[model samples]
Target: MAEQFNFSSPPFDLLRAAERERLSEALSVGYYAAGETLIAAGSAVPCLFVVLKGVIEERGEDGKLFAQYTSDDIFDIRGLFSGSSKHVYCAVEESITYELPASVFHQLCGANPDFGRFFQADLAAKRQLARRDGQNLAEFILTRIAREHLLPAIEVSAGLALGDAARLQLSRGADALLVRQDGELGIVTRTDLMTAHFRDGRSEAEPIGPLAHGPLACVELGDFLFDAMILMTRKRIERVAVREDGEVVGLLHLTQVLSLFSTHSHVLAMRIARAESEEELRGAAETLHTLIATLCGNGIRLRFIMQLVSALNEQLLERLFELLVPPALRSRCCLLVMGSEGRGEQLLKTDQDNALILAEDLPVEQGLALMQRFSEALLSFGYPPCPGGVMASQPAWCKPLAAWQRELNQTQLEGQPEQLMRMSILADASPVAGNRQLYEGLRQGLLRFAQEGERWLPDMAAAALQFDTPLTILGNLKTREEHLDIKRGGIFPLVHGCRVLALREGLEERGTLARLGALKARGVLDEGLADNLAESFELFLQLRLQQQLGGARDGREHGLDVARLSRHERDLLRFGLHAVKKFKQSLAWQFHLESR
Candidate 1:
């Protein structure tokens, strides 16, 4: 058997000696009788089976055949890592399987970075195909809460008097009050009392009980913010009591979360908005670099922080435009950012790419003058002038809704490669302010036109595979002595691959992270796989920021060198980079890019 099989090749060739032994042991020879259901979808099981002999078919919930498992094929490890009961497909067959328990597999892989990378590479390949067929998309990528501060929860008994609660609230400078009553929970907030007493003629001293409200929604301390967001959205509540079972632990409030965004974002924006001098504005821009550091250090989710920072930038620019642009033009149009800024994925400041989409039939010269003023004001607010000169001040980018739509339609047909490349940025276009509907309409038209005949995706997929994964011919890991551009190499593959997937699927979530999640929900990508991509993108972003901050500290723009990364960071990067490589390969094969 050993002589017949090629173990000296990839994926098997990638595994370590210890890992090979573990795999052999895990693949014990056991036979299942015919008509046996080996594993069911959505079951929280500890182990995944690899076929040692016989065969199995993966079936969907509708009882239709999906994929058949044969020699060397793997199944169910995704579920093992996901720690979720939602299996995307079911296993069926009387088969001999090598059972790999999740715990042992995790330990074996953890100790061997190469072995772990090998498995992720294989999984990523399968996931790309699953993405197309809507089968095996979910790949598990771990997430950590990025919050820097967890404020202590102010506690009070449900029976505590209003006065005592008030004192506790004031003493602690806390906005939320948690009430544990009779082994259950409830809450009486400051707003609850202020409205009740002042508006409803209730006495403040009247036991806060009359106003207390709950079936106290709570989250465990260890649960991620994704968990917290789900609980908040599902319950329509502004706060959740952080709990260890029924015992009151801490409290998470929406205001606090928003404040976290504010601390890292709004302060710089506000400074920029209020600055009256060039020096002050430069100082504000310098402050922004620090805020970026804090946000990354706190482990803030890159996606959420991006949106928050983008919103603050919009606010800052809006105020600047109000101060600089003539009032009449401000009333007629808004300064909107397209592309990365539009998608709320921007972290570090790059180039300024934006346009003015004016209301129809405005006096042409007046509007042009207003845009000039707006562009100058943006410069004052620290946005560098666009190299492509697509700023609102540029007449080429500033147009009526009808003209913009026509331009987009023409770009699709002209098929000039350069124009098409420029058009790609349109995918990230988002409206920041005035005449937002106009921006939205233009975006819809572009999406409809680009994806309508399914003409754009194949080309986009073809372009996406242009970056080859830097895998060595001898199978040794490649390390860059100079900084590796994770954004160009790792992030772009997933971003462009996801964009093509979203366009094909008609997924309208414009942000890269949101698009991935939406695609997962639509079953175009699996939840676990989407999680992996999202996590990888975020980790890369986080590392990039760290590199930038270190450069800022040293007064030099030190590029990211993968070789310089700590052992643990390098291991993670290898896993993430390999995932991107395999995903691109999957895209190539699925869309027939290589053959084309």
Candidate 2:
């Protein structure tokens, strides 16, 4: 017998050791000459094939290659279950393959439910399985809040004296106390009592009710630890009241959430929030890469990681702005992060694509000087300057709100490609620091322009379909110089198409996935198509990240070498690109851009 092949990847990796051993013993080895047909179209798949030391090409009826399976690749799961094949598998080179008889394969599947589901499930289910595997490795973050030992919620009457409330909280070793007033509940933290007692020079005999804040941020006990972390991040609060069935159960603090993971996002967030100088923030920013690497290595979902990182990045940028700009001037300007950073999809620190929206009366020159210094500071903090000069340092991007509205009006009228692209970029703009109202005013103007400029929608959507999807008519990846531009072919179509739809629907979501959901909710997109687009977009992002991590040069658009990707990854890329093609077709139909 030939040596047993290792089943260490997904679908196969789900098999139990005993089952694998049994299948391994039943496996036989076979050799094929180059060009030999292993599995003919329409023929019953006799055995599950695992490429041992050769390459197998799966060709369609027209003899066009659809996929290639190299060493360690498994094939024919769908065919085996269906009892027939739609395509013929031929050896691309003289090859050896491990053959597991269909009978034994069935037996192994029957014995292991997980193994069966892995092979029989759809792509979405398989993705869920993969996520489960990742979650298993990082289960601490996924732990339910109810599972942790929680402090009892110390209760105090509404009219209790400050001194008595303080004594009760301290004596109970409680960090927070719940106060009942007018049949409503409020929370007073130890910090609140101390501030009222010492900082304000308040009499200890005064009632504590004034110190308690009503309508507190609270989370259900069933929420995951990660949910609590997000709540804390967004609310800018250190603690939240944990509720169980509408009753206060305990208090969850930021430190408690941080204790669950070693990534130290909580610590980084604190450092960014507390840093008063550029050097301190820079030190904190330097550790971000290590944290990202750790999270990625642990198989944490890229989406969750991106959210946490985006929040932390926003904090850093906000702190930097505060340090560089005067409080009075900062209040008059709105700092906006455009493009990927604004969309919260940035996995790596790219360039700074930012703008500043100044109040109508502010001096443009003064704003420009402050922005120039801010952009330079970002470069020192590791963000490269935008190659297209989209940063706030550019005088044009640092314009007053009225100037921005005029620019939008002019762009809508001109409809020039460059101007339209700029408009599209700004459509994703999100306020990072300074006066959010200024950004909101500018955004409302853009939305109104988008709504009234119906003719511009097609032109904006046309960019999405400009590049041909990197798939050939023969069902093969179309490549130039043996590389595929994943962004142009897959990412942009979904992103820009969704942006156009979001604009039409008046949705404020900046992220592509979130926009898809909003579109689905607004009935602008079918649920199935939305789900497919979301998965496809995620696939593209994952592939791009993988390509970048594989040592692609920074500061330039990167491409993926199809030959270098694993068979599974190649299949996913093909599926994602096909989704992009469908998305483009839909866009053309909706926008009437097909004739163009």
Best candidate (score: TM-score): 2
Candidate 2 stretches greater than 4 Å from native:
1-4, 53-73, 131-137, 147-149, 154-158, 170-173, 179-186, 198-200, 213-215, 243-249, 474-482, 546-557, 561-564
Q: Name the TM-score of candidate 2.
A: 0.91
lDDT tens digits, residue span 102-153, model 1: 7777776687666555555533442232121212111101222333335457
lDDT of each: 0.63, 0.82
Looking at model 1, residue 189 earns an lDDT score of 76
User: What TM-score would every model get versus the actual structure?
Assistant: 0.58, 0.91
| Error in Å for residue 252 of model 1 | 9.1
lDDT of 2 by residue, 513-547 (tens): 89999998888887777887888877777666766
